[model samples]
Target: MAGIGHITQDWEPVVIRKKAPNAAAKKDEKAVNAARRSGAEIETLKKSTAGTNKAASSSTSLNTRKLDEETENLSHDRVPTELKKAIMQARMDKKLTQSQLAQMINEKPQVIQEYESGKAIPNQQIITKLERTLGAKLRGKK
Candidate 1:
């Protein structure tokens, strides 16, 4: 940046960014009609194995199982709101989804969701993992 401003070159002190050119220009009707591409060739999806659907179907079952397990082991105690907020923020800042974060912490995604939603209080082991995995502290200062 030059300290001295020059009027001859039409120089401004502040830098302005030119917006990228857009598609606002009118397209020719002939060109527009030509660009419209469609074909009579119908492409059909490949027939998948029965196992493909089995894999898809299993996910729902696994989810239900996890939900059932979480319900059974619901945290009777309430976790501190601040700690939950911290965990949620840290997890988000680290760009880790609940499932991904849970995988890193060796816990289920339901656990992470539960902790964030205040549906379940994390145990000490889970807390330690959370702190280590997220590079955050679920525990308060001693």
Candidate 2:
């Protein structure tokens, strides 16, 4: 029996150093600056955000801190027990694996596993898809 490591092929990595054209870099810089000026998709981190009062908006700082806290403190308990049980029972009734159930709903199997195992909470759209595919209501009832 051979392990995956033993089955590996010979390989070589190459390092090439090339200076990018100045015009393209300048064009990109101008485009990024325009976007930042227009308040488009990018957020710029300045050289001195740490322990500095130079930042204009206190609300931005507060919102960023709140977002960080919310992300770090997510709860598995947010997944409803009723929804979990309903998905499980329906899958069993149909004699379907989690992968099969996910396929029927046009989702990935890992998504089904995540919701069923209470590691994640489904949104309204996902709940609707589950209800339709599983033939069970995930909302608006006991």
Local distance difference test, per candidate? 0.78, 0.78
lDDT of 1 by residue, 1-142 (tens): 6887865766659888977535532244553444455422433356566436776676699888878778455436877798789999999899989999999988899999989988785588898889998887678785
> Model 2, clash count?
0
| Best candidate, TM-score | 2
lDDT score, candidate 1: 0.78
For each candidate in turn, the TM-score is 0.45, 0.47
Off by over 4 Å in 2: 1-77, 140-142
Lowest lDDT sum, 10 consecutive residues, model 1, at: 35-44
Error of 1 at 92 (Å): 0.9
- Where model 1 places Cα greater than 4 Å from the true spot, the runs are 1-75
What is every candidate's alpha-carbon RMSD to the true fold?
20.5, 20.3
TM-score of 2: 0.47
